[model samples]
Target chain A: MPAPRPDGACRDEELLAAVILRLIAGLRHVAVGAQSPIPATAALLARHLGKGQPFVSLLSSARHNFFTDGGRELFDCAGQGRVDAFFLSGGQIDGAANINLVAIGDYAAPQVRFPGSFGSAYLYYVVPRVILFRLEHSRRTLVNKVDFISAPGTSPPGVYRPGGPVALVTNRCVFAFDRQRGRFRLESLHPGHTLEEVLDHTGFDFDRPERVPQTPSPSPEHLDLMRGVVAPLLAEVYPQFAATVFGFTRQEQS
Target chain B: MSAIFRSLDEALAGIGDGAMLVVPPEYGGVAMEATRALIRRGLRDLHLVTLPASSLQADLLIGAGAVATIETSAVSLGEFGPAPRFAAAVTSGKIRIKDATCPAIHAALQAAEKGVPFMPLRGLVGSDLVARRPDWRVIDNPFAARDPIVLLPAIRPDVALFHAPMADRNGNVWIGRRRELATMAHAAAKTVVTVERIHDGDLLATEASAAGVLPALYVEAVAAAPRGAWPLPLAGEYPRDEAHCAEYARLAATEEGFRRYLDRYVYARAAA
Candidate 1:
């Protein structure tokens, strides 16, 4: 019998990273903003796989980021079509692709107010591909409609929107957004999650195939690269995340 | 153009009630010491703008009742969790919120820097924030056939306040590669800066330093406040006091606890 994959094996975060890495393929530039550990990991991994073809920019790092002008430069780059892909998360995301990063409940008196929108509204419109990621996949997060639209999923015709939501990745499943149809189509279900559970937990309606497929797990080689290679790169900006996700500790090089 | 001041209090002078103030994010050189000084001054009704987003500074000011209205994209405690005071005040209708997206704030400030009435942006076409924001308008792109774009009014603040790694005798602050500080200074009527220390010579004299210098032309005042960006980071300089931040997150979870936090950290330290 084949031996199990070594001491540092895959976890949910690693799986999510692999999924995001696949989604970001063929992009020239993938930029990750503050506090997004998974996307940052995926971007770094993609760079490693692409042999530095697609440049990765982690907004939190001083060394990795080439933008001399600070956070504003990131917006400028996105507006100029220099950024290819970006990641956005929300307190609540509706089926129509609307994301609520503002508050939940009422606008006047919210029960919960998330960290204000972090350039998602602008990046959603400018970046060619914007991937919506939320680790928690439940009715509360995946809602029928967001309380306050921090960034709408779709825009009116003839608007100068070169970008919008492309796909949403959650713990339970993956959904590809149809910009023309203004709805999501279920692509695949993650392992250990069922269609019924996804339907039960999801608050929004989406199209789906009669026979859904399971999200493929990362191969042993991919897992090795992620833990050994990408994890160290991630430590530059997100040390805590790298430590927590892959048991990666910064090592002193000779 | 000797903008040097002896104290944070003196540097922050001239900023009175109802003045519009702009600041940077936690990592991008936030003036935490200056912010505390402002809080201690018992300032009121200030219009505070976070360049795009804020963390502790906004919440601290809002909690202290120093802010009347805030115009920014978002505020949170980051990894520590949601900002308690900001959430409470917003939910209780204590402060007026001008919810913005990240780039919108940058674009508006850019407009102010260029002395323009407004700047047209590509996004916010169908956002509810667009519908709610009476100030932001959607107009046909003048150059395009039928393309609609969002136009944000200029955000010309009365003062732009921040902390930096160093400043020189000529009042030129070396902000390094964090150029948003320069943008803020250009957009505001006056700019107040607090630095870790004074550089021995003119920052603009050296080519390496000149690239990162916010010239004295835009600076109104400067003060030396070492570790000015404490509890937060100064980009390439120091890491945040993470343990303190975590403790702050733990204590600032409730109104009473936040009050105690103010008494212990902000008020008590100032008195000491």
Candidate 2:
């Protein structure tokens, strides 16, 4: 077991953001939806790293969003192959990358109902790279098969799908999606977690290398940029997350 | 010509039981005061079409038993977590839910706006939403063989209701960059709105504001209701009352607690 880090070191969120930044490195545009602070952080960091090459659009932020035409423009942009990357989370995600954002049990009488599918049903097909992110890495969330397919991982041969899952980032590990095989391959385990821990908690089967590398932590420069620049920018849209993680309060921004 | 109503209730008078009411998303101006007035009026069996998605406004309407069916992509309080009343309603089968994706809702409304019978959307071919929604159809595209797409029917609502930062006496509502409000107004048969204040001059008079104005041509009525989008934020005006939203989420978790909330906020307002 890895020992807990001392104070002032890189947090788990910072590590995850670093991992996500690598996945979306060369993308032209990365758009983030509501309630995804970590992905938002990564997108912002990616923009900073790219020297303003990749435009980051936070749907909830007035400062970050460039859409003058309103919410529909996001979808329009995705359909036109303009949006390069996006993120989606699920109540239950399966091995094949199927995500269930609707209900847990029967469609008529559900045992547990999550928020209905947002843009996942559409953007998952249009956005070139859809990053599946779930902070909780547990059996209940990552199931063998989703109860409902809010958006499918892979479409049939004839389906018009320019986009699908490219990678899934969880707290425990990172898994890269293979479009041909329609499955996930464990890429790396996060710091302080083991392959056994990932296997123990995961509900679905996935391919893994014999010797998995540990996910690299954010560098000093990455930390400096995130903590100093991105944290304040993030405060405008996700005040709670900024306050909790970076101690950048909304009051400070105002 | 758009009629300027004396009160929010009067502005919403044309919307009766079973009316199809289209509303803006949470970030777009939400007509929460009008929603409370609707609850107070005891309107029932409404078919709510929340443009793409919603938060407090949809949940409150569902909790108040004002909505019989909801056609929306999702309804969750952004940070506060899942909408308790909406979750309970879905679990208990109290209201009919027509589950849709965000862009599907937008496309459907855009179809109505363009006077088109149906609109073709790119995704949702393999989604279970395709299976559930019998109204949605998958067909081989005529333009290209072996390519499949989904078509969504136009959603023409009976009334479009929302709150805005301001509206001129001529009834042009200043929505700024929130153009979805204009889309809703254009698609709906009638459009009613509550404004924070009435502008002294024409909203379309200035070239700068004209681009953001929803012309009085589409507006049926406008009423003055200060702080109309309470608990929900209106852009450039007031920020969201996070504490009140958290309180609502906590209180509305249980049936008894939800009733207490209604008595305090919804029903109590009748006297005020």
Candidate 3:
């Protein structure tokens, strides 16, 4: 791949759709949270694809209710990890890639109260592969250490571990475990973002890749499904969230 | 040959102001259409006491002043909009809050249906929640003379309004799943069933999983109302009908908007 983009070529929403479209499939139950873009889009896309295929394929079809009625059952059931893959996010994620959705301060009383760990703890235990998606890129967003470990990473890294966050899919690029150190290692940069830009936003340091790859360009098909289908669906639940997660036009910003 | 309603007003004629009612989720797959109408009526202080938080209907009632208290297990879902409002209402002391597990709530209804004193449940020992709930009695099994166990008294709701995909005049109902809503109907003093379509009258004769709905003796009304479960769904009916539920979620998101909603849609549009 050519030099990695300085600031991620694709919009975050496009990456979100592509990640979900690729990762989530063939599960009977798909659970998400109140303000989830990936799970919400996945459930809708799953249903649009076929309710019978995803949930029924898992043999959990009998218990699953795919994306009908605003995907209530799916959102409610995210922690059980009966879902094929999960989409998760947090206020601050550390160098180790541990998630923090509960709070930003001390345990007893938090300085800032985000929706205290919707199902991060449980989803960490159950879901097979979790795509941790973050929209904002700022020092505050990427922390040296998470204020709270809302969800734990694998007990042992670079090994076949079932529980814990599987990958970190963010606005910039994908980050994976540095098998030896168990710290987040920069694997690829978005098409447009550079290493300097990534470091500027990161709160902690990660070992650099000799050459970061471009996050694959979403196919026109993927973009259509994402912008046309997924974005509208997310907008319904979270009204304020207009424009794409990463595809914010100047119009949306203004 | 006729539509399911005698006119929304006549169908609603019986549900007077401050009518006490009870509803349950079939474990889940709670219906929403008919209940939405009842919700509209209740949006203005109907003295409704929800047995637990099964139906999305709880939020609508809580806003209308129909529901003064909320009783149930820890919310199964991490994020439910009405939950925040209902929780706020309870904590703010605007509504009373009570604790009951999924099993306890079901058992109570089962007891009411079986005409028993109380039903035994699997868990809830030494939980701090035990201290808060008054309706639950921790007493020795006088009959068995055994160690003390928690006894949740049967819930005999004054009226039960339920929606099914289809119901016959005789009151036989069929739904997509085997849920707990049936138990609530069995225990209630009266059951009013609204169905999406009444069918060719032989509809009640079909042997579906939920076929043994409240018998005619127990059912007082059978109005036909489709999309009963708006924000929620009735299994095998139609896919969740998201656009419809989204509209409701939008309307119910705020306290003031939800109340005004109750007034305009629930009260004004109410057939009665």
For TM-score, the strongest prediction is 2
| Each prediction's number of clashing residue pairs | 1, 0, 28
In terms of docking quality, model 3 is incorrect
Report the lDDT of model 3 for residue B48.
48
* TM-score of candidate 3 against the unseen true structure: 0.55
Give the Å shift of residue B175 in candidate 1: 1.1
Q: Which runs of model 2 end up more than 4 angstroms from their true locations?
A: A1-8, A252-254, B270-272
Instruction: Give candidate 2's chain B TM-score.
Output: 0.97
Q: With candidate 3 superimposed using the best TM-score fit, by how many Å does residue B17's alpha carbon deviate from the native?
A: 12
From the highest DockQ down, the ranking of the candidates is 2, 1, 3
lDDT of 1 by residue, B51-143 (tens): 888999999999999999999888988767788889888988999999998888988999999999999887888887888799999888788
Decide which is better by TM-score, 1 or 3. 1
Share of reference contacts kept by candidate 2: 0.84
- For candidate 1, report its TM-score: 0.95
Where in model 1 is the C-alpha error above 4 Å?
A1-9, A249-254, B1-3, B270-272
When sorted by lDDT, best at the front, the candidate numbers are 2, 1, 3
Question: By how many angstroms RMSD does model 3 differ from the true structure?
Answer: 9.6
lDDT of 1 by residue, A1-254 (tens): 11345564567787888889899999998999877888888888888888886988888787678787777888889989999999999999999989999999887788877778889878998898999999999999999988989888988777778888899999888899999999999998988889999999999999999999998887777887887888788776676677777787676321
- Predictions in order: lDDT: 0.87, 0.91, 0.56
> Order of candidates by TM-score, top first?
2, 1, 3
